[model samples]
Target chain A: MKKLKRSARLVEMTQFLLARPHQLIPLTTFAQRYGAAKSSISEDLAIIKEVFEDEGTGELQTLAGAAGGVKYIPKMGREQALHFIEQLCEKLAEPNRILPGGYLYMSDLLGLPGLMNEAGKLFATAFAGRDIDCVMTVETKGIPLAYATGAELNLPVVLVRRDHQVTEGSAVSINYVSGSHKSLHTMSLSRRALKEKSKVLIVDDFMKAGGTIQGMVDLLAEFNAVVAGVGVLVESGEVETEQRLLRDYVSLATLRAVDAKGKEISVEPGNYFSRK
Target chain B: MKKLKRSARLVEMTQFLLARPHQLIPLTTFAQRYGAAKSSISEDLAIIKEVFEDEGTGELQTLAGAAGGVKYIPKMGREQALHFIEQLCEKLAEPNRILPGGYLYMSDLLGLPGLMNEAGKLFATAFAGRDIDCVMTVETKGIPLAYATGAELNLPVVLVRRDHQVTEGSAVSINYVSGSHKSLHTMSLSRRALKEKSKVLIVDDFMKAGGTIQGMVDLLAEFNAVVAGVGVLVESGEVETEQRLLRDYVSLATLRAVDAKGKEISVEPGNYFSRK
Candidate 1:
């Protein structure tokens, strides 16, 4: 790398920090990379930090002393999050989304990269400051959301398979009832997928009766891993409080109703706003 | 947004372009947002563009005329990509990753957000000029990679499920053989999941006999969609070339051999480098 002008250096520095979130970088490294002095690097970072703060994109935290440098903490502002969620609710409420058996069609929404990215940021913002070792989700539908959150938090994502696969080697399997009918189902996690006593954040696309999430929790106990927090894109509000298998989780939207016969659907912002 | 200093504006402009890849943003929009003249905004974009190109991060494409604006096309440099894939092969070569049936366990590597982001960029770069409407992959393992590529290309991702779910509504399913054993498998995609006659890019984590990928292609045919391109993280070099089901695909790494008894494994950079 050659020494660049201040304008080019600023552009490069911003891109560098954005690419590597949550990781600390020493000021000396940037100084040497740009062939500039430490003081000059500090001043450059200061300008970047102010713009980041003003835009509400994230935070650029600088630490003092020899061991410390700077870290980019990705965050979504409350107003931005609310605005995004409100639009998501409206999209989710479209009458055409109502399928048979009171189910809502959300695969299309989940498939949108931009929408998933924003959802991931919201979960990251909701779970920020926690000591989350990794993000966990079940196979299939929840995988994308899990990865989205993982990318935002700069954490590894551990997937729980619905059925055991030989490629995973040794694994722990558990059975739990799911859905309104309480049908028996099995979920498994690879033994090597998670470390013992690790603090894990659970995320999923949807939660109904909280059975699948509870299954995940019960499976985590086998490895002695702690549940740091749980976040879901949508939760079934129709489920009775007592019938729900788990509590103390965050949701971005609540599926209030799906009138299959009437071909109507209703969705609202989740408990996230009320909790705040 | 209020007017910002030149340095602050530069940082903000860089962030803005990075976030909305492939989406055109008019210079007038930025000019209005920053309360600056279009000339000033153009100068800021020029600085950002230079840094992006020099760093090999990507290209800032500027369009001319009334509806014209700037678009960011994310790309990974050839040298950087080669270095990354080489390191990925080394990681995949670890003996512990070799499973019982000569299969390599890649869930850990795929779980890594940083690694997947880079792989996505590589795929995006490989298929940059193609007319890709969406990214397609199978259930479970390939979803994250598909979403990653979709994120880089600013396209939607459609998942093919092994078993049809009621929530997905009406779907088109096809049966195909997979793995070296050539066992039959069923894969289905929701009819509503994709538009008719769409151009799609297919991506996956691994390809042995190319059965799974072939299955995805067969399923795509049912939707009247066109296969724009195909990409994979790793391909099995051990499989006879004649036995492979698909041709003309990009791979980052190649699995040469896996000695289960000796606990030894071999991997190398895939044809991605050779193709260049």
Candidate 2:
């Protein structure tokens, strides 16, 4: 790359940082790329850092010394996050989104990139400091949200399949009872998808009695991976507290009730808002 | 929102545009947000537009007059795309990635957000001008890639499941012959996942005999949707070309051969390089 003016460098640097979140970039790398001095690169990064924090887009952390450089940490302000969660609640409250089993048809919302990006950022902010080797989710709905969070954290996502596919090669399979109905369900992950003794963050779209999450946790046990943390987009508030399978997890929203006859639904921000 | 200075305004505006790719923003939105005049907003957009195009990040398109706002059309330069594809081919060529039945074990790469984001940008660039309302792919492996492409295109991703789930409500199921073996396969999409007569972009992680892509195209017919375009991350060249179920699709890489016995594989940039 040719040397660029400060203005152009700022723009390019911003793009570069935005593309790579939670990954450190040494100052010399930027200096060489822009054909500028390390001091000049540092100055540009300072400006970017200021703008990023001011806009509540993220944090640009500059580590000092030889092994240190700069890393972009994607974050959302409390006010903005609250607004986004409120918007999500509004969308979730829509009447047509209610399904027969009190399951709330949220695949549409889950599929929207805009919403997923917001959710991903929120999860990233919540788990920003954790040493997560990968984001794990069951196959299907949670994949997008997992990918979104992984994108923010610049980590790989591992999907736990409901049934093992031959294409995955050798795999680890486990059967567990689901929360909602106590039905026997099998979930599996390729042995190669995860490493032994790695730290993992588990995430899911919704939790009902925490059965599915427990299944994931049990599956992780087989991999010898530790659960760094767990995050859920929504946990069923209607489920009796005693029935909840996992208590040490973060949630973005709580589904209090769903009256199919009245076509009504109630949602509130999850523990994410209250947790420090 | 507080008014911003030009420097701050440029940074915020860039973030806004990048976050909402393919969506048009009226100039007045920026003017009001920054408490700046339309002319100043226009100038900021020009600077952003210049850098966006110059860096091959994307195209900043501006519409004139009342409803006019800048839109970010995510794109990857040919050089960058080639480099990315080559890197992907190298990864794919690894002997371990070759699975039984000539299947490429690409879920790991697909799960990596960094790789998926790049592939998303490449597909976004290839289909930037197409009239696409949403992206479609099968469940499991293709979900991340579909979401990645959808994220770049600023569209929703519709996942067609290999089997119908009760949670999805009413779904349209279609059975198609998959791959060279001509085995029977079934795929389904929720009735609400797509709208009638919408233009859809089909994407997948890998293509062998193009059966799955064709199945998605066939499934789209049930919804009265049109296949605007098809993109695969890798297409198997070892499969007899005549055995491919469909043509007229873009592939980022081509798997030339996979000699599982010798522990060697060959992969190259796909037709995406030749297509306009």
Candidate 3:
């Protein structure tokens, strides 16, 4: 058989994969398209696969069996995810993030995808083998990251609002104390937003005093849903109250804030990227 | 020259691209490395390039000069970025996102990467080809997206805080109102955090009004820096002030809250992937 030229073979391989997402394509088809040996197609697959994997930006899966073929799954690995969050935390620890009245100026973190992607990936992996129907997060800040995680898992994400809007219809409201020790603040979720018995992964941009998270836990109970896990992008280590409520928690960085001189310390977890 | 078997050629090509970050590799190198004719290596490069590009997760740069080579730059296209954000905005618009008070629930957006990666790419593209010395964002929510944008641009990110911290060493502070009009807020930046004459890109998770964004703009002016761009993952048409402040603005989704039925609408921008 005449061997197909390499350029033609490459184009055929790309076309085959692009046609199907999350589905495997056999080597034989590529070889047949190029009139080259199966071995030639395998070589083409190897090159394509390596570039995606090395970038830690996408996935190329090689299925080895009678149905063996390669599939590209856009995925971020555990290590890559952690490394990304750690870097964000380090930047967060800088003095610039501290706002008056001890608040962190977090508008940027709320919008950033690199940090959000890593944080989402870390939490997603924790619940990977579990049955999670949806991702739950609070508003203003958590929206971007939750949206990211939901897309990665291909699951629908539901938001829990703090106020009752005329549009939300009926909502189950929970009264909680504000972080500033003000009057009881109300956190609510739409009655129809969560499905009964659905497993949920709760995520928040920042955790302090456990009031908002606890409110979410209460809201999940309102629907008879299961709280699968809890994740936070930034957890204030200085605040001692929140640690007691966390179960299966992943924090991108810990905030060590010094009160007197206004100094802050940051640390990243080692598990963000795989060592091997 | 004799061409190597297809399998061996692929493995070699994959390994080579993985080691080089942001640098382009030419087809000729593969021919020389595998002792294959230029035509053969060209075939391999074409195949590999197509797969990565089709995924909308990474970039492939083809150079024609003798000094030029095939460079695989890890990036996401504009359309993919817009699609991901549009999906998130749709989720956010649900009546479910409304809480009891006038606040949004955004935990899901912060935890999702597939979405965040897209948002990050869009922000990176907004500032592409510009002189951006550093990326600045406030802490907590904005940190992750800022890091993602910085990583893509290969630049260092600076975090701004709300208050003065001794650890960050004498920060400059500015007070601004919250977009929600809930309270007065302060934004801070370490006196030494940003260098003078630097070009900065401002990014965050959500922009309700231009309040926080304006504060950051003022802070940059204090540092004698230029605002290269302003990017947000979500822009609330509910609040319409941010559009006039940025020369370049990109968002995955726009929130148009209409009527009291709690009905909201969203759409992704086609330009997110068009530039690539």
Tell me the TM-score for chain B of model 2: 0.96
TM-score of chain B of each: 0.98, 0.96, 0.75
| Cα DockQ of the candidate 1 complex | 0.87
Candidate 2 scores a chain A TM-score of 0.98
| DockQ metric, candidate 2 | 0.69
After superposition of all CA atoms, the RMSD between model 1 and the true structure is 1.1
Candidate 3 regions with alpha-carbon error over 4 angstroms: A1-123, A137-152, A156-196, A203-215, A231-243, A246-276, B1-59, B62-116, B136-171, B176-197, B204-212, B232-276
Q: Score every model by TM-score.
A: 0.98, 0.97, 0.57
State the displacement of the C-alpha of residue A218, model 2, in Å, after optimal TM-score superposition: 1.3
Q: Which one wins on lDDT?
A: 1
What lDDT score goes with residue A63 in model 2?
A: 95
lDDT digits (tens) for residues B1-276 of candidate 2: 677666666667777788888888888888888889999888887888888887889898888877878889999987788789889989989899877866667778888988988898999999988899999989878788888899989898888888987778889999998876789999988899999999999999888898888889999999999999999988888788788888799999998988888888999989997998
Candidate 1 residue pairs in backbone clash? none
Per-model C-alpha RMSD: 1.1, 1.5, 8.2
How well is each residue in A92-156 modelled by candidate 2, as lDDT tens digits?
89989878776688878988988998999999999999988999999778888898899999888
Q: Lowest summed-lDDT stretch of 10 residues in model 3 chain B?
A: B263-272
Ranking by DockQ: 1, 2, 3
What's the distance in Å from true for residue A60, model 1?
1.4
DockQ of 3: 0.12
- The TM-score measured for candidate 1 stands at 0.98
Best by DockQ: 1
Q: Give the per-residue lDDT of model 1 (tens digit) for A1-276.
A: 899888889999999999988899999889989999999999999999988887788899999998989999888888898999999999999998877777788999999988998899888888889999999999878888889899989999999999999979889999988857779999999999999998999999999899899999999999999899999999999999999888899999999988888777888999888876
